[model samples]
Every structure is written in C-alpha cells, then in structure tokens.
Target chain A: MRLISTYLIGLVFGLGIMISGMANPAKVLNFFDFAGTWDPSLIFVMGGAVTVAFIGYRIVLARPAGTPLMEAKFNIPSNRALDGRLIGGSAVFGIGWGIAGFCPGGALPAVGTLNADVLIFMAALVAGIFAAKALQTLTANRAAKATA
Target chain B: MITEFTPYQSLAGGVLIGTASVLLMLTLGRIMGATGILAGFFRPMSLEDWTWRAALLAGMVTAPVLMLAVSGQMPPIQVPISKTMMIVGGFIVGLGVTFGSGCTSGHGVCGMARLSPRSIAATITFMIFTAATVYVVRHVFGG
Candidate 1:
C-alpha cells in the first residue's frame, strides 16, 4: 500500500515536472540565462510549488501527532545548522545545473524519453553518487586516523 | 531570442508537484527529494525502504507515457549540451546533492515551504552559482 501510494505520488510529481517544461534542458537553460532569452517561467513554478506545499504541510503537521497513514512518524529532517557542506555542495550542484540544465528531479522523468544523452547523464549521475560515498568514507577514515 | 514565458502551465505543474509532496507526507511521512530518493533506491537501508523507492522510481521513469496520454504526445526533451558536458554536469550535480543533502525539490520547494534557514541559504547559494555558470557559459565563453 505504501509502495502504491509512493508510485502514484511520484507519477504526479513527474507529470508536474513535465508540464512545467522543466524536463527540457533547453528550457531550463533559458531560465538561467539572464542576459540572453530569460524565461521567467521556472520562477513561477517554484512559487506555485512553495505556496501550495507551505499550506499543505501546515495542515498535515497540525493533524494529531502520529497522523501519517502508513508511517509511524514523520521523517522530516531537523538539521538546522548552516554548514560548509551544504553551501559548497549547493554551489557545486548549481554549476553543474547551469552547465547541463538537468537537475536530478528534471532528468529522472526525461529518462522516459529514452534519449541517449539522458542515459549518459544518468550513468554519470550514478557514478557521481558512488564517488561521493567513497569520498565521504575516505574523509571519515582520515579524520579517525588523525584523532587516533 | 526572447524565451517563451509559460506562466499557467508552470504554475499548474508546480501545484501538482506540491500535491505529490503533500501526499507523500500524509501517507509515508517522507520528504520528496529527487536525489535523496534516487540515492536511497540505489543503496537501500532495508527491504521495506527499497520497495517504495523502487515504486516511485518506476513511476518517474514511466512519466513520458503519462505525458503522451495527457498532452497527446511525449513531452519534448532537449539536451542542449554535448555528451561530454552532460557527463561532467551530471557527476557534479550528483556529488553536490549528496553533500548538500537535498536538491531543488527537497530544498527549493519543501524546505522553503517549511521555512528552513539552512534550505534558504543553500537555495540562495545554488541559485547564484547557477546564474554565474550560465553567464559564463552563455555570455563569456559563448558556448
């Protein structure tokens, strides 16, 4: 049941991405190009999403505790510290996004298009994720060794 | 060339995305961060976790068919960059999201809606760099 719900939710989210023109790298790139043909459309997408989500979350959270249908409790992140990793990672992600105009959210749905380029990008993305995990482990090990 | 501004469709689509997020929250109490979800799908913590992630991913990958039904055609997807650049960008994006702990949907949409200061900072940082990168790519280098 949870799996079915998640799938339906994912479908709706993907459809939203498709309808918003976000699935198209060219359209995404245009939004980033201020000096060139800047399509202010993406901003509206964010605005609309945030507005609806803001309202929806408040209502959901206000419901009695342990209210979620399937889960025992909400799993929202509580980390509030502004850290170097967050800023650095976000900036790095931005550079990549600007370069390709393919954020993970946008690219996943595009995979259905079966474009070779999209497949290549997905492969790289998976590789990158593995690389990040390796890097994380390496850093942790180095830190432990230093402390020892 | 003036880029086409699509206000209605973008907003409507955003609403749908927001709805999905809300539904997920209501049902499983999960955040709908694309990178995070995809990562979990690949390196699942448990069988129960994997099942939902797999289901969500299946839906996402099959969305083009849904588009075909609703829009009467597969949504057109254009990758303006070269294959080499796509790989580079995808890798960087993957690394960034893993480190940042969220992407646009997680940070830009849900985070902002929840009014998280960390997400706001991250969003601002990424948006600045994205614009800068675009400026460099399109204007400076003229790629």
Candidate 2:
C-alpha cells in the first residue's frame, strides 16, 4: 500500500515536470543561458512548488505529532550552521545542473522518455553519490578515531 | 530553444504534483524519494517495503505511455550522449543522492520549506555541481 502510494506520488511529480515543460532539456538549458535566450518558466514552477510546500508544511507541522512515511516524526533540521561540506557540495551541483540542463528530479522523467543525454547525466549523478558516500564514511571513521 | 509552457499550465501541473506528494505521505507514510525507491530493489523482495517501491517506479515509467495515449504529444528528447554514458551518469546521480541523503525534490521541495540545514546545503550543492558540470562540459570539453 505504502509503495503504491509512493509510486503514484512520483508519477504525479513526473507528470508535473512534463506538463510544466521541464521535461525538455532546452527549457532548462535556456534558464541557465542568461544572455542568449533566457527562459523564466522554471521560476513559476519553483514559485508554485514553494507556495504549495509552504502551506503544506504549516498544516503538517501544526499537528501534535507528525511522522513522515518511514519515520515517526518530521525530520526537521535543528541546526542552521553552514559548513565546508555545504558550500562545496552546492558548487558541484550547480555546475553539473548548468552543464547537463537536468537536475535529478527532471532527469528521471527524461530517462523514462529515453533521452540519451539525460541517461548520461543520471549515470554520472549516481557515481557522484557513491563517491560522496565513501568519502563520508571515511571521514566519519577518522573523526570517531580522533574522539576515541 | 525550448518552448515555454504558460504559467497556468505550470501551476496546474505543480498543484497536481504537490498534492500527490502530500497525499502519498498522508496515505502511505512515505516521502517520494526516487533514489530511495530505486535502492529498494537491491534488498530482499520479501520485505514489505519492496512492494511499494516497485509500484512507485512502475508508475513513473508508465505515466509517459499513458500520456501518449491520451494527448498524443511526447516532448522532444535531446540528451546528446551514448547509452553507456547515460548509464554512467545515472550511477553518479545515484551516488550523489546517497551521499547527499536526498535528491532535488526531497531536499529542494520538502527540506527547504522545513528549514533543514542539510537540505539547504544539499540543494545548493546540487545546483552548483549542475552549473559547473554544464560549463565544463559545454566549454572546456566543447561537447
């Protein structure tokens, strides 16, 4: 049941991307172009998403206790501090998106649609995730040893 | 140049997607994280968790087909890469999602609203990497 619901949610999300014209790499690439022929349609998509999310968060958070699908509570972050990891990661992601014209969410539908470039982008994205995880584990161990 | 959809179209679509995500969470108690869903395939199938993941992925893949039947208009896809390269890209994205702990939707939509530091960081990182990769690939490599 849970799986079915999740899949439906993803389907809707993908459909949203497609209908919003985000499934097209050219629209995304145009957004990044800035000078040549800027496309600001993404701004509306972002705005709409943020608006809905803002209201949704309020309703969800107002509950005496709220739990996401897997957990028993909303995983709200308590810390607001910025660190090297944050900055470094953001830099890398932006560069990739700007170049590839597809972020992860936008990439999935593209993959299903069988866009060759999106597939390449997705592949590299997975590789980057693994590399980051390996590094994270190593760093965690080093920090643990230092503390010990 | 990619043609832009009107604001009405974008908003209507956004509403459906956003509402669907909320409905999924309320009904099933799960966040629609794609990387996590895909990862579910690697685990034992007997686990109840696998059932939903498979269903969710199926829906994603099939939505286009359904749309084609109804609308008769599939967007033009121009990836400009080989199948091998695409696979490689997918792996990197998977790895990034794992390390980052969420993809753009998970972090950009959910995390950002909740003021999650990690999500903010992840979102920013993801965006930056995207931009840099584009620059390098399009300019440095001249692809």
Candidate 3:
C-alpha cells in the first residue's frame, strides 16, 4: 500500500514536469538564453512550484510526528552551514545545466522519451554521485582521525 | 490557447509534483529525492526500500512515455551541445547534487518546502550559477 502511494506520487511529479514543458531540455535551455531568444517559462514553473510548496510545507510541518503514510517526520536535514561545498557544487551544477540543458528532475522524463543525450547525462550524473560519496567518506574518516 | 505552456499548466504541474513528493514521503517515510532513489541500486537491499524505490523510478520513467503515447508527440528538443558535452554536463550535475546534498527537486522542492535555510541557499546558488554558466557557455563560447 505504501509502495503504491510512493509510485503514484512519482508519477504525478513526472506528469508535472511533462505538462510544464520541463521535459524538453531545449525549452529549459532557452530559459537560460538571456541575450538571445529567451524563454520565460521556467520562471513561471518555479513560481508555481514555490506557491504550492509554501502552502504544502505549512500543512505538513504542522503535523505531529509523521504523516499517516510514513513513520518518520516530513522534513529532515542535518547540515545548515552555507559552506564551500554548497557554493562549489552549485557552480558545477549550473555549468552543467547551462551546457546540457538537463537537470536531474528534468532528465528523468527526458530519458523516458529515449533522448540519447539525457541517457548520457544520467550516466555521468550517477558517476558523479559515487565520486562525491567516496570523497565524503574520506573526509569523514580524516575528521574522525583528527579528533581521535 | 497559446502554443506555449501557460501559467495555469505550470501551476497544475507544480501542484502535482509537490503533492506527489508529499504523498511519497507520507507513504514511504523517504524523501522523494532522485539522487537517493538512484543510489538505492547499490545499497544493501532491505526489501521494503528496494520495492518502493523501484516503483518510484518506474513511475517517473513511465509517466513521460505514457504522455507521449496519449498526446501523440512532444516538441523537438534543442540541446546546444554534442553528445559528449551532454555526458560531461550530467557528471557535473551529479557531482553537484552529491556535494550539495540534494538536487533541484530535493533542495528546491522538498528542502525549501520544509523551510530549510540550507536548501534555500543551495537552490539560489544552483539557479544563479546555472544561469551564469549558461550565459558563458552559450553566448561567450558559442557552444
């Protein structure tokens, strides 16, 4: 039952991406083109997402403990620092998005459409994730050793 | 009707995406972050986690295919880079998500929705950098 709900949620999210034309990497790329034929659709998409999110967060956070379907709380995060990792990572992401026109959320549906470029992007993305995890582990070990 | 996606459509999409993220969390106790979902492939299987993650991924992949089936076709994509560039770009984004601890959906959607300051900063940084990079790559380098 829980699995079903999760799948349904993912489906809705993907549908949203498709309907918003976010599945089209070209459309996303056009939004970045400031001096050229700039498309403002992404702004609208962001606006819509933000609006829904505002209300949604309020309702979810108000709940005591987890929601009906899950055991854990609605939101969780350990780190809050605006450090170099955040800045550097974001810069790299931007460069990639600007060049490929595919972010993670937008890339999933693109792959479904059998776009060769999206598939390649997804592969690279997976590799990057593993690389980051390895670095994170190494950093944690170094910190632990320093403390010990 | 405008050929382009209108505000109403975008809003509707946002609602759907937001709702799905919430619902998935409620059902599975898992944040609907794509990086986590994709990473599950390598993790030691607890049957429960695997089941939902697979379902989540399937749903995402299938939704667009279903749309294409029903809607007949979508507009042609306009990627500016060659296949190699796209691959490199993907790696960069993947790296960003890992270091930032979340991707756009994870940070911009779930994290921001929770009023997380880190997420907000990350989202802004991601968007600004993305815009700046796009400007340089497309306009400056003409790629």
Top candidate (lDDT): 1
Per-model TM values vs. the true structure = 0.97, 0.78, 0.90
Q: How would you order the candidates by DockQ, starting with the best?
A: 1, 3, 2
1 versus 2: better TM-score goes to = 1
Best-to-worst lDDT order: 1, 3, 2
lDDT of 3: 0.74
**What is the full ranking by TM-score, best candidate first?**
1, 3, 2
Specify the CAPRI tier of model 3: medium
Best by DockQ: 1
Model 2 chain A lowest lDDT segment of ten: A69-78
Q: Quality of candidate 2's docking, in CAPRI categories?
A: acceptable
Q: What are the per-residue Cα lDDT tens digits for candidate 1 across B35-68?
A: 8899998999999999999888888877888778
Where does model 3 exceed 4 Å of error? A64-66, A72-75, A145-148, B1-6, B74-76
Residue B125 shift from truth in candidate 2, angstroms: 5.5
Which 10 consecutive positions of candidate 3 chain A have the poorest summed lDDT? A66-75
Clashing pairs in 3: A69-B26, A70-B26, A94-B130
